[model samples]
Target chain A: MGDLLRRCLMKRTDPDAPQKRRRGAAVALWGVMALLVLWALFNLRAIGDAFVQFHAFLAYRFIRRALIVGMLVSLCASLLGVTLVLKRYSMIGDGLSHVGFGALTVAMALGFVTSEGLPAFLPQGLRGAVARLCAGIAANPLPFTLVIVVVCAFLLLRISEHSRMRGDSAIALISTSALAVGVIVTSMTSGMNVDVYNYMFGSILAMSTSDVYVSVTLSAVVLVLFALFYPRIFAVTFDEMFARATGVRAGGYNMLIALLTAMTVVVGMRMMGTLLISSLIIFPALSSMRLFSSFRAVTISSAIISVACFALGMLLSCVYSLPTGAGIVAINLVVFIAFSAIDATR
Target chain B: MALIAIQDVTIAFEGTVAVDRVSFEVARGDYLVIVGENGSGKSTLMRAMLGLVKPRSGRIVYGDGLEKNRIGYLPQQTAAQRDFPASVEEVVLSGCVNRMGTRFFYNRADREKALGNMKLLDVERLRKKSYRTLSGGQQQRALLARALCATDAMLLLDEPVTGLDPNAAAEFYEVIRSLNRDHGVTVVMVSHDLSGAMRDAGKVLVMNRGMDFFGSLEDYRTRFAEGMVKGHG
Candidate 1:
């Protein structure tokens, strides 16, 4: 029995023993990759048929636009998600999206009035420019919504940090108020009920070409800013007070996070809806955190997971005639659960 | 020459005073141990020295070439902070942020300094480990490594041994004593263990919402002998 126990301990401690297990893991990984390639090849014809059907459909242009917007939104939201989730500000995304909803409703109401006609007191050129701007805002409310939501997000952050109200309570108060105002404004505005419904429960098929352009431009801005300030953001997320003590200007980094989140929330609201958009920011980060320990690793994994899940969700929705927002959220939920299970087993 | 001077500093929250009319001075190479019960503003006074809070009145002035960024601070950690998702190396490397001024990335010098500090703290082998997985003693050692990387001039620790076992705490105290004695690093430590702290501290500041006593260890022991017995009783 002593000899057997010694042998068992030697086997466990031998470094070369894990080499065999690693080889097995490598083989399994390659096998999975090969199977995925084969499956893609086998489904090529069906995918082609789906594409043809999509193109022949009346809303092909809208579908293309929605796809572009969805990809951009998913990328930015997931990138911002890692820091926000770690900093315990995950719910800020939800609050800001509701604020965007309220702003969208107000913009819609203003657009309706502008289309009816500007007052004659305005000069000719100024009238034309104002009319064009109002018309643009009416067509794509994201820019206007972005401004309102960013301002409100900053306010909420300040209130939470400096006021007697706690963080969660502040977020709840702001989000619920914005939601109530949005519902009231939507009811008050006549003839835009369908438009409001589309915003509430996103209609990807209703996205315009300009929406795609705006989303791409804003996503590029967010990506560039995030890359430039990655180090500062990491410091702030880990310990804001410590970061401040080290002269890193933690508050400035926090403002940048709020700004990025606002932009992501606005862009995402078109496809994920105001109510469901925060899931795009929350799910991927949480899932990646289960598997990766470092900030950089978790961030990269989150981005990949978010893009993959969004693509899968879009494809499933297109093939099965499902609600786009709900489909994406459901896929994210599954991925989160799978990740949690894997982490538990490990 | 004094390294830092706190002149009649008063810190308050809302309408309540936390530290009132606190005056103290830390001379060069002094090991000052601040002892107080909970809610006695020991941590608040330290924070004031670090410039974390604006004093309601008076001022904290630094001399002897010490600057705000050059002071290493080991703040009291909460559970959530202890569980921050970062590797030991990453946490230690962040101490270089002040020196890296306007630079986005840490350079080779910063990396060498971080590694050296890790070696000094005997945490070099755990460089790649996740900070959250470390035991209490190891985590404090890692944080000490980070603080050392920040500056060699001085260290200000707030309850650095709160959760450490007796042996771990004793080891930590030895490490701190060597840093002060051998390396000549000024230390301002806030601690609850007066008996243990009295062994190494050059001066002691006993506080209870105000300055109960501020003098050398021998003078403090002699001045507060009856009070200490009554308090313990």
Candidate 2:
């Protein structure tokens, strides 16, 4: 037992062993990948026909918008997920999504009240400003929800860092309260209850043009920032303390991550619903992690996996009339399991 | 002048003092080893020097080329940290982040420095390998190579050999000794391996929540010899 342990723990002095094994594994993996690609090529006609059927639907414009937004959101979420999951802050996504739900509920309620009730206590200018802001939110709830989610994300990070509260406890406290507030706000608003429910369960067909525009613009910003600061983010994710010691400004990078995560969560809520959106952030990264070791490889592979999963899920939802959010999460689960099994065999 | 001067520094966590009124100076090319039992604040003192922990009172002043973010650091690692999804090259290259300044990307010079340091640490072969898959000693060497990429002036290691087997620990010590003796890089290491540290260190700082002794290794041995024997007995 002792000898076996020693042999396993010690460095392999035979340098050629690892190289030969790695070469063999690489060849096998590439062969399997080529076969899969060939199979996909053979089914191209069937796949094209399925997409043609999808385009024939009257609500295809909204579905198309949802697909674009979903793919962008998935890419951003998976990129950010690698850092967050490794840092043990995966639950921050769940907490912030709940906060977004509350924000959406409050925004809708305020929009309803501003349009219906004349709020006699306010002055003319104040009322005009409030009415304009409420009108903007009524047109698209994402901006309002983005503000609240960003604030909550910052607060969550601060509380977890400075206070005695652990990350899990903080996430629980914030999420439960936000969920309660959302429920209360939804109950209070009578006419817009359906809209709140739509946001809660996600209706791709209900996404407005403005929502798609906002999602694309914000997601592009996230992707650009992520690319620009890739080195710093890598340093921060791996060893925050050492990054700080090396003058990486780890706090700034952390704040950037939280902000990007908030944007992804808020934007994704339109397609995946607030309740299920975090799965988009958690699943793809975890799935890719099972098969990849390096940070770059895992991040890129996760992004690809996320986009593929979203596309498949959207197809499944369109064909079976299932909830888009749940469909995407289900596909992600299947992919995660498959990847885990493959990793176990290795 | 000393490369770093700690004048009555105190470090606290949430208003509770972890290190109290500790003063020390590290001259250029000096190998200063800080030895103490657990909870003795050796790590805290090192953190203060690196500016990772703010001194609750007093100040740490730098002289010559030594400044904040100009020293290499190898922090203590946990199991989760060891499993970070990064290649050895990526990990080593990140040490150049401070030198990149306002630049967002690493330049050719930074890559060259990283490569040179990896070669220096004998980890150039494992450059493309995943860091998590490396053995304990190899991981430490990779991390040490990362630290070397940060600066040529000094290195501040926090309990660098905590989990290594006896042979690996000895090998690690020799590598550190070479860096100090041959490469002329000053080292301030926090360690529990008092005897191993004393073998290479020019100065020794013993602590128990505060500075118990600070002097040459011979002086430490002579001053604490009786107490050590008594404790052993």
Report the C-alpha lDDT of model 1 over B72-180, residue by residue, as the tens digit. 8888786566667688898888887878888878899999999999999998999888888898898899888888877878899999999899899998999999999
TM-score of chain B of each: 0.95, 0.95
Name the top TM-score candidate.
Answer: 2
Please give each candidate's TM-score. 0.86, 0.89
* DockQ class, candidate 1: medium
- DockQ of each candidate relative to the true complex: 0.52, 0.76
Alpha carbon deviation, residue A296, candidate 1 (Å): 1.4
Summarize candidate 1's per-residue lDDT along A186-226 as a digit string, tens digits: 78765457777777777777677777887898789988888
Q: Is model 2 an incorrect, acceptable, medium or high docking prediction?
A: medium
The reply for model 1, stretches above 4 Å from the true place, is: A1-61, A112-140, B228-233
